[model samples]
Target: MQATLMIYNGTAAPDADVLRTGGVPLAPARTTWPMCGNTCGGPMQFFAHLPVDYGVLSVFVCQNDPGACDTHDPVSGANRVLLFPSAELVPVAVPEEGVTLLPAVSAITTAVVTLEPEEADEDGLPPDAYDLARGGWKWEPGELFGKQREVLGSLGGSPSCLGDDRLPECPSCSGVMEFAAHLEEGIDRRSAMNLGGDLGYVFVCRPCSQGAFLRD
Candidate 1:
């Protein structure tokens, strides 16, 4: 997969039938050796399955030995993000190499919802990507029957945490790594990943094909 920095606009949590950490893949994967962790030296655990404007995006992470992997380094081999054209997509079975599949619950159906587009300026200039993702969080919920929840569909830039300038540094070069994506707890209480109430931050050093995962 060509490495690119991307931010997808979706529900704060992942959606149904979407691949997630410890969840079985949707269809036959393209290959047997789906993803091998660069640092962990084994198959990486699936973390998310996202459908974007182009196609599907799959995210994986290696928590085999978190601290030992130096997850703060983008090329530490602890994490990976892949994008694929829907037509060419193939699903993979979970590797039976002693990898633990963390517990996840059934996906929640939040209900019908509509998202308000990010506001434009008097000149009709589109809002900045960072600003849109940061602000989109507040507009996600509404009173359904009585509970406040998000409607299904892309909400545009629902970044879990931003503006803290907590970007990680590359362990190899000591250079500042680039922010890549934000991972949240699953759509609700049932399917939430074991992030300990922290959002997962992904970073990458494209030239090195190395990635890192962090939580804050």
Candidate 2:
């Protein structure tokens, strides 16, 4: 399988036209900043700004209270995924309270990674292609364990280590959402979006202009 691996390219201008984690989010005019719907009831933390073929996928998760808000549940009102039009987006106004943005704006670059299946697949249980490719990504051939911190996750692939039964449905149309991207914590722990040591999944229903986010 082939996947587009995201590489960290150092700090970036908040609104730069690149894949990135952290910084202020860009949204259409009159779009209000999304607030967490759980007991915390504070502004959700901005996670990533992913530009895809269809549109830009903006992600947010509740960080005001972390696990207490159930950020891992798609419909728990803890995490949100927004698919916005490619044009006329403006940076959203920052809120004065709570954890609303990441501490650093990390830019991203991409590389196409190809992986060959392992022999274990013969038993009908195949390892995640994205995980395999990422785990083997080395800054230099001589390096052991690879530079995993530089990896920001993947674009345009099926969710890693996720099950079909957990795939979320679009709230508007009641249709299964398409897998959009996979997100890691970040290259820098100080500014990373907390995922409770799990991978984040993004799903979208382009026709309905809606999306869902969860972690596993």
TM-score, per-candidate, Cα-based: 0.52, 0.94
Residue-level lDDT tens digits of model 1 in 1-216: 011222222333323444233354433345454444555587766665655444455556665665555444335556655545566445465677744344553332222233355577788765554433333434545622421122112222433434445665666676676555555555556445545555566555555544456666
* Model 1, position 202: C-alpha lDDT score: 57
TM-score of 1: 0.52
Candidate with top TM-score is 2
Ten-residue stretch with the least lDDT total in model 2 = 117-126
lDDT at 41 for candidate 2?
87
Local distance difference test, per candidate? 0.48, 0.88
1-216 per-residue lDDT for model 2 (tens digits): 788888888888998767899988888988888988867889999999998888899999999977789988899998889999889989989899999989899999998988775655676876777888788888467777788888888887778878889999999999999998888898767668899888999999999999999999
Error of 2 at 153 (Å): 0.7
